[model samples]
Target: MEMFGKTLCVTFDDLVGSGVMSKANYKRYVREEKFSFMQRGGNGRKVLIIYDKLPDKIRTEIDTKNPGAKDKIKKQQINPMDHRLKSDSKAVEFYKKYTPKISLDRQTEYVLNVKVLNAMVALEVSMRDAQGKCGFQNNKEIREKVIALCENLRERYRHTLPKARLMEKYAAYKKYGYAVLVNGNSGNQSARKVGPMEGRLLLKLKRSKFPVYTDMQIFEEFNRIVEERNARATREEDKLKPIASPQTVINYLYKTSIKLWWYGVVHGEIAFKNEFMPQFDTKLPDMPNTLWYGDGTKLNLYYKEYDKKQKRMVARTIDVYEVMDACTEVFLGYSFGAENFLTQYDAYRMALETWKVKPYEIVTDNQGGHKKPEAQYFFKRICHLHKTTIRTTASPKPSKALSDASRCR
Candidate 1:
């Protein structure tokens, strides 16, 4: 049978007994030099056939009769469990395809790391060869050396690498170069089960906000569509889609590409901007009183006050609009009321009256009252009336500063 491109021979007596050739015909062929053999050493008149020199028909017969020989040789040659061993070209392909794409510096570092590891393995193998203990056959001494080396490596790397496993890796490193040491899972997308058709259907279902589909709801709806299509299909190949789990649909929704596309559509545009948009650093003024921050918030504490119209004590929480020095975070002015433009106007008036000077800039959020044309007009006229230059208005652009200021207690 074939073993590493070499074939082992069958004996003449076995071939004759198997009825591949008659004993008389074998003798005649031998006499005519049609085939060749060698007399078995110290065995009188016994002969062995050279398999490579045999006719194709005889070789085929021998292989069919002794099918287990190739398997036995392969088992002896290499371990069946070592699946990570790959060809040289495959190792190079994996390294190039899986290396980190975050940046050039990171990719270079990763390649260097793999090269260093592979170099160490090469050094160890070279040392073993120099000591005449690198044989991988049924050699007890070499096996012991390899096992002891594996124990030290196991402690160093915290991995349970057996001798056979180490040798298998060494073999690959010798043949495949440093790329064999690179991890194969860096860009692996083999686990993603959702196909194109299913992805399209999922996105289509996701875009529907009438019922605002949950992951499970979307999966169920997808299943219903697939089933409907399959029921109407006349041929098996015409079936609409494959079966997918609810988690698969959920995973697709959470993917970066899908989230970027659908977040604004599902929630409001403002929410999507807050989550995915980048924020610029707001530089603070150098000195105190140069810049002031203003925002409105509800005070949690409730107070009971007498109401003349109701003839009873009414309990309610009040909204407080406050202004603070951006440099010192010191509160300068505040006004309490049911939230409205009047409270914001009163708060700015209080700040100017308390500070005795208007700030260079006052930043406030675009709340309902803050953006009112009347309120904007009031701000423009107030500081000019006070004989001090001022800037006070809501920013036209969306910003995290507004969201942060609105959370003020």
Candidate 2:
């Protein structure tokens, strides 16, 4: 920081010394819009520079005391990166052995040569300032000789040529004094680029009624549409770029609409209800014969009857009526007859005759003859006379008695 270097006369090394704050945190502070920093030397050479705010009174006092503190501390070499690189004895060895080697292109090599020249100038200044000189007042012949030492470093380390684009690569480090700034997004990100056409196509495909379609199929359709639309394109660049890979499209669809994909590909409304839909606990009759249920169904088997007119056997069907105990799954009584049908009177007669004890409550479906108003009134009137309650539902849900019977069978 300028305050640390110029006003407080503190080198970066001394400012972060004794655990006042970490160099990493110092760099973070600068990046967080809390303060600003300026590089004194060329940007690559200015890696160590930082500027921290101070109180007005303190700044004035320091300025008075140290009239040219920046010039005085200019002798201090305060590169956290250089410090880290040189801290360990095996740094150079490790860097040489494990670091990736590079062969720069012609354009890259030329720019690096310019950075190398800047490095040479930095080396010369440090060398002269070490001695009793303030300018190029040092011997030009000797200065030039010493400065040339930094030039040949590129040959030793090829990656050293690109003299670190300070703002792009190490801006946070310079501002906040952090030696390591995570460059997580530094590499080529060409694959992650989602163009508008690709996105529109993906949505148009994935969110369609055809969610059952495979991503690859969607991708094919996507290309087809692109071709069709671009047939009218007035410019070459106006044509569509290709959509993402099939897997990527699948992943994107899953993230955006897992429920949509599930409903489309895995399950329908019935499966959804059976799986994720909630159900409430329902209380059942606690004692046997406390409740009675009655219902009728056509038997699956049919018998041949003699037809008087045709003088031949004709197919005839029979209906079954049953009365059940709600709690025990016991079929109390059932009536099926050749001459009898499932009328409301037959239903009432079957139920009244089936149970040995009078039912406290009776359940039946609101269907067929039993659904008539007169039939309902007859049951209610009979139930009232018998001190019983009659309940009927229009929905074809099986009673608990039927459920119990099913479980037993």
For candidate 1, what's the RMSD? 28.6
Best by lDDT: 1
Consecutive 10-residue window with the lowest summed lDDT within model 2: 80-89
**What is the lDDT of every predicted structure here?**
0.60, 0.49
Please give the lDDT score for candidate 2.
Answer: 0.49
**Backbone clashes in model 1, listed as residue pairs:** none
Go through the candidates in order and give the clash count of each: 0, 5
lDDT of 2 by residue, 50-138 (tens): 32354354345445655666555554433321211112323223222321222234324434443444454455556556544322244
Candidate 2 backbone collisions, by pair:
1-50, 1-51, 26-176, 27-176, 27-177
Model 2 scores a TM of 0.34
lDDT of 1 by residue, 232-270 (tens): 878876565644445457667889776765676687667
